[model samples]
Target: MNFAPTPRTTSLRSPEKLRYDKATAYDVLDAAHICHLGYVHDGTPRVLPTAYARIDDRLYFHGSTGSRAFLSARDEGVEVCATVTIEDGIVFARSWFHHSVNYRCVMAHGRARLVQDPDRRLQALAAMIDTLADGRSADSRPPSAKELAQTAVLELALTEVSVKVRRGGPNDDAEDLSLPHWAGHLPLATVAGEPVPDTGIGVRPPPYLP
Candidate 1:
């Protein structure tokens, strides 16, 4: 289904790159492990980089219970925006003006609320851990009651969202295409290195680690 763009979700720059489909938004969100959360702190706006996970149509993120941004979002129901970006390559062109990046990103706006239900909170926490590695939630120790009490899990609905993507080679002007400077895109990817274990040095890493 296509998400109807609200004023907040509209892209002013490079509107052609904006996508309204749910699949594109979910792909970008699920591929990235972290997101930038933008919210108002006191009278000033702030952006925080934090880990996140998506379950069905909800996005969940956690923080200290005393965090100001979380408190405002949960208690005051203030509007917040979360963004996830995956860079595919670095586009180099003949001219500096044409240099850009090939990337996929999603931006979502909503009023996040703290997950108060114990079962729901546990589900959110499990989903987050499992995102790091499939089946990881079952292998790791569950959070204790005291730890859960100190942690805050916030949920934001997957509405009012937009996905933007940039692909292909550099867009150099016709006149500059003949320049001697190299022109192309360098593909990028995130690769996981061998696991460095601490207390479980002799144990093999879980097969799920990618």
Candidate 2:
């Protein structure tokens, strides 16, 4: 499915880099586990980094029930924007103006609703854990009643979404090519390091871990 861009989602700066396809948006979102959630609280704009999970066309994120952002969102049903970004490389150019970073980003806009249903909330929580590491939810203990009561799970549909991507080498002017400075992209990636088991657990590392 293709997402129809609203005035707020249209890419006025780099129209060519903007994507409206759901596949592109989902790819960017699923590739990253963290997202920045933006909302207004008491007339002040705020953005907080949080973990998220995507199931179908909906995105789920959770926070402490006492959190101001979550409380405000739950009470008011205010508009929110969730963005996920993955930086692939740094583009070095002959000139500072041409230097840029290669990245894939997706922005979703909607009003988050508090997940009140117990079964759905559990599923959302499981998704969040599994997104961090596949099969983790099954290995870990499920949330207790008190723990669930202290958490706030919210869902936002991916109805209004946009993706922007930048890749390859820098776009330097023809005259700048003659400069002595090297121009190339330094690729970056997020890699898993050696796993360190907890001191209390003697069990071997699970197969799900990298």
Candidate 3:
């Protein structure tokens, strides 16, 4: 399935990099652990980094009940944009103008609604834990009533979205190729480090620990 582009989703800057396919958008979102949630509060635009999870065609993010963003969205059902980006490499070119970075990003636009259903909220929370670390939700304790009460979960339908990707080396001018400067892309990635056990825990590390 492909998302029909709207005025907000159409990438006017780089039409070639713009993608309307749902699979591409979902792939970018699945590979990312965090997203930047953009919304307006008090007539001011605000962007906040948040942990999120995608289930089917919906994206879910949670925060403290006292959070201003959540509160505003819950009350007004404000339009929001959720974006996730994964940096793949740093492209270096002989000329600075041609230098760029390789990345995969997805932008989702929708109106966020507070998740009030207990079952749905639980599912979203569990999905979040599992998204961060697969199988971690089963290995850890579930949220208690008090904890659930203090948390605010918001859901945004994935009806409008776009994916953008850039890869390979920099596109340098033909004349600048022989400028005697090295030109190549430095690959980058995110990898897990050694697990550090808690001071009071004697349990063996779970298999899910990367």
Model 3, range 1-210, lDDT digits (tens) per residue?
A: 999999999966879989999988988888888999999888999999999999999999999999998888777576899999999999999999999999999999999999999999999999999998898899889999999999999999999999999999989999997899999999999998777888997657788887
Question: What is the Å distance of residue 127 in model 2 from its true position?
Answer: 0.2
TM-scores, all models, native as reference? 0.96, 0.97, 0.97
In candidate 3, the residue pairs with backbone N, CA or C atoms under 3 Å apart (3 or more residues apart, or in different chains) clash, namely: none
Model 3, CA-based lDDT = 0.92
RMSD versus native structure for model 1: 1.2
Ranking by lDDT: 2, 3, 1
Tens-place lDDT digits, model 2, residues 1-210: 899999979966889889999988998888899999999877888999999999998999999999987888776565889989999999999999999999999999999989899999999999999999999999999999999999999999889999999999989999999999999999999999878878897667889998
Q: How close is candidate 2 to the true structure, as a TM-score?
A: 0.97
Question: What ranges in model 3 sit over 4 Å off?
Answer: none
Model 1: per-residue Cα lDDT over 108-198, one tens digit each: 9999888899999999999999888879999999999999998999999988999999998999999997899989999999998888878
